[model samples]
Target: MLGPLAAGAVFFPGLFLVSKGALRVLLGWSEGDAVLVSTRLVSSLQAVMASSAGWIISSSCRDVMEDRHWLTEAYVLFATPYFAYDVFAMFLCHWHKQQVKGHEEAGPNGGAVRAALSGFLRREVLMVLHHVFMVAFCFPASLLWRRGKGDYFQGVLFLAELSTPSVCLGKVLIQYQKQNSVLHKVNGVFMLLSFFSCRVLLFPYLYYAYSRYASIPLLRVPLVAPWQCNLGAALLWPLQLYWFTLICRGALRQSGRRQKPPGS
Candidate 1:
């Protein structure tokens, strides 16, 4: 609930600002750009708001099912598909990024050949490990949530969530620490926070929902303490907003750096 609210406050406003800013930057238009563009932005915001509301309503309904004895059925019908889609999208995006990089490096025919050869290997080998790790972390938490035995399993889930951010942060810290660009450091910090928010907030809620409501042996206990869940969700939006800002800033800085006259 609070998660959705936080997302609304942080992301919705930030999205509006970014889109408006981008339009201004691209078109060199002032506040009096196009009436239609403004209208469309508002419309898009409304759509996002509607979607968030829908999630809240659906989550509430799932909670109700947990209060009853139907959590497992409800979860399977609703949550499982969403999780599947998320995982699939993650892997697909990863694969796409690799392919794009390969194409850029190899150029035209060589790039195409490399991408064709590497794509399946990347998906089946590299991305499969990520999927396996996510499941390994999540499944035990589901068991704990189902059995109402909230102890070490919860800790384990938390650790698993932390693992990804820690790895990512470690890489940046080790490899890019000496890069004195303020933008790079800022981007790294936000990236770390984004990962932290996902681990500390998003993944936990997901696990809670899955364990208590979504799967075959629904635990039906509150996955996390209510206050914690709400707070975590509330924090997610700001983190995402910052993350987006950092990415855009980094891109701008990188572009500027690239365009600078050498030895000038």
Candidate 2:
């Protein structure tokens, strides 16, 4: 556990610095842009690692409830530090953007730090809460709460990250003012589909998987399952629904623009 934690501690920041430097030198991106892109690049890499681990664990577990995969615990520990790193990375990105926008020019350095922090927290409270819960609640629950059962479910949960790369790509495209490009449009479609299928539909699929295994009806599985399992799913699904609605709205706006007559 300590080993993976130490490795992640070094790896994420190292990769971020390397990525930031490369983007600055090779692409001539501004500090703010490089910070933002590097953070997203790190996120995409983590998503791939988590999703691959999920796939491997999920595929190997024949018994959904009883089967155990060694990678489940290993990968979770390795990736745990990423949540903390990401929060700091996000703040750095936000701070650089504030500088780029000249918000810091109006205030002393100390004041700018406070203002940037406050603005970042306000803008990102939901996401920050999500990360906090993962580190505070989900980490122990994943490793300790289950008493060594249900690795399959955890693997499936990790698989929810499958949408992240597309989401990252879409953000980068928009940041670069290429939202009208074909790549952005194609990526938007992919993001919507992946987010919906992997995230929004995931909880239901978990219930269905268990119901089939237990020989119970789909709706009844929730009642029959452990309270903790039901509670976790209940807490998580609503967030996915909310995010999905936002994604849908974005897709609709993009579609509306695409259909606008030339020259408006």
Candidate 3:
């Protein structure tokens, strides 16, 4: 498993590199901007693959996903490295953008490209925190998974990322200024549906599953146990809810404008 994870870590940057080149040549996107979109597209595709497999294997368990410690361990073992890769990749992109920003200011197009990349990075503050938490906690837990207490609980948390593909696609479409395209419209609709299903509507059920299957009831579970793993899990709900609202508003506002047509 670690072998596959190591391979994945090695290949993640390669995926970013290939995708960035394709976007730049195919779409004439600036290098920094192309990499920004390519990175999300690649990450989103990986999320779908991993989460889809998780959901399927989880479905076969005698009970809910939270009851499958092995499955949880399997996913975390595979996913944590990619999460680490993401943190490093984002940091590298940031540093590269900063180093070139002053030189690139000579051209207006270059400045806009840099600004677009900066805007995307700024919007990822919460996502950066989310990644940091996973790397700091989930990665280590999965490594020592055999001795861990909350294995099943963590499996369920990873499933919450199922909507990420749509979210990524929606952002990429926006970056390309494809607001009025039919594909963009369709992707927006899916983004709203997936966001609600995975991030918003499914959360209460996740909590219920935790309460039902946990060794101790969720409320009774001590936050300090497992060295505050429970605390990290408990706090993610507010972040999900906040991001879900943002998704909904953006989707709805765009859909409305899409219907209005130009010069109405």
Candidate 4:
């Protein structure tokens, strides 16, 4: 648990820094302005990440309590409300977006609102599916690891997770190469490394927990330690680096106009 917490702590700061820096760069802010805005933004994002991590840790600790039956019941009780809040939040976002655009006049051949809504809905649906799959896969995989039969299966799943990010990186690289943007090329490389680290180190631990401990009879013992959690969170460093690289690349590209230099 300490591991995970530490990882989260370390990772969130870096993630916040990268995100804030990227935003500043994109907006063409000077270094001083970027640093100032990034500082505030990162601080706010850090608070949110810390709060979320606390809730998760607390929930895990509750699950491991000695009063087994009561703990299980408590877990369900708390989880329901938490999940409900998430659902409500999603709805609120959609409603807010609709309200913001409700008064706009529809233009000729303009389906901007529909297009935006459709894209948002699509992305939301995919995000939900991704979470569902993560839970479903992690749960069974963890059980299998605990039972000593999940090694290979977990390996495969880990590979799949790793592959998805690699594919994403590859696509980014292909685009970068086509655009001949040095910044994007560098970003692609960093992102590839980031994804690789996540797939290699983080997924294995996740698989171990999901396969072995999620369903374990004991309520108090965390499958993994906080330190391990922190280590997992460290994956964010590479992720942040990758994101920064991408942002820098995009900013550089957008800041200057260049005509196509040569024929294919």
Candidate 5:
């Protein structure tokens, strides 16, 4: 656990700085674009790395408690704290971004910071909710709820994050005025398909694996989960569904069928 985490702790920050510099140096992106793109790149890379590592570790473990794999435990430990930080940082960034935008709308005297603080969640409710769930439900599941009981299962759930990069890229494409590029079209397709596969389709597998391996029946698995855990798991579908709706809406932007509004 410490190994992957120490690696992530080191890797995430290093990558963020490197990617930000590369974007500015190689592509000459504007400050806003560079920050946005670099952040997305860091998120995508981390999700991919986490998911891949979880799978590889699980494959090697065969039995988490029985194998007594410190590796899986370390991974979960790493992820729990990292995600809590991610949730906090993500909310702050969104808030600040919205605040700055508000500041712009109000002109030089608009008091955007005050405006943003007063109506913070007006634009970031969903993102805020998602991160809150991460800190509340997912963190506990990974660390305390099941504790050592289902570390492997907790890792499996992490794979659902694999689609997030595509989602971020889709937004980045639109933000950077690449709406007409073939890359945008390709990213849109990936955003839709990957979100469905990881967030929608594979949901059942997440539970099914838990049931099959844990010897807990499908109907009874929820009984074992902390009530909050079940809520967290149940919420995943609807939240992703909501984002999927947004993805569909964004896809329409390419076709000139609709224009996206702010805070979407």
Candidate 6:
């Protein structure tokens, strides 16, 4: 467990530096541009790894609550570092963007760093909170609270990352000032679809799966489910719905912009 965790600590930051340097040399992108893209690239890779692990664990399990897969706990431990790393990566990305925008001007010692950190927290408070919750709460729940059961549930939760690549692509397009392009528009639609299906509806699907397995009605499944499971879903589902609505609104705004007259 510690080995995988330590490896992840090394892997993500190492990948970021290597990717940043490669983008700077090979693509001639600015430092800010490279950092932003490299961070998103790392995120997309993590998402792919998670989705793949989810598929493997889900497919291997016959009983949703009783079956265990080696990858379930192992992947969770491996991924734990990613959340911590991403917070720092996100801060780096934010700092670079702020510098590009001149939001951080030369000032008293440490003043610029403090301002950048404040802005980052303000802009990304929800996302930062989400990552923190995953590491602090969800980590222990997956590893300890289940008492070695419900690896299938952990697998399904991992599938929630399936939407991340599209999300990353949308950010990349916006970063390059290409949000008006056809590809960005298409990716916006795809992000909406993927985010809705994979994130927003995921918890309900979990309950439905449990219902099917337990031979109970869908509504009844929640009532009889373990309190921890119910509490976790209750806490997470609303956040997913909130993010989905934000994505939907953003997509609508982009669609509206795309439909306007050229001069307008």
Clashes of each: 3, 0, 0, 23, 2, 0
* Candidate with the greatest lDDT versus the true structure: 6
| Candidate 2 lDDT by residue in tens digits, 169-248 | 99889878898999998898899889999999999999998888989889899778878777778778898999999999
TM-scores, in order shown? 0.30, 0.94, 0.73, 0.30, 0.75, 0.94
Q: On residues 178-243, what C-alpha lDDT tens digit does candidate 5 reach at each position? A: 877898888878878888887776667666766877798888878875676577768877887888
**Model 4 error, position 198 (Å):** 14
Sort the predicted structures by TM-score, highest score first: 6, 2, 5, 3, 4, 1
Cα TM-score of candidate 6: 0.94
At residue 213, give the lDDT of candidate 6: 89
Instruction: Give me the runs in candidate 1 sitting further than 4 Å from their true place.
Output: 1-83, 98-120, 123-127, 140-146, 151-183, 190-264
Residue 91 error, candidate 4, Å: 13
Native-vs-model 1 lDDT? Answer: 0.43
Q: Which RMSD does model 3 reach against the true structure?
A: 5.0
Q: What TM value does model 4 have?
A: 0.30
Model 2: residues >4 Å from true position, as ranges? Answer: 103-108, 262-264
- Per-residue CA lDDT of model 6 for 190-223, tens digit only, reads 8888898999989999999989988999989878
CA shift of 247, model 3, Å: 1.1
Worst 10-residue stretch by lDDT in candidate 5?
104-113
44: Cα error in model 3, Å? 1.6
List per-candidate RMSD values in Å. 13.9, 1.8, 5.0, 13.6, 5.1, 1.8
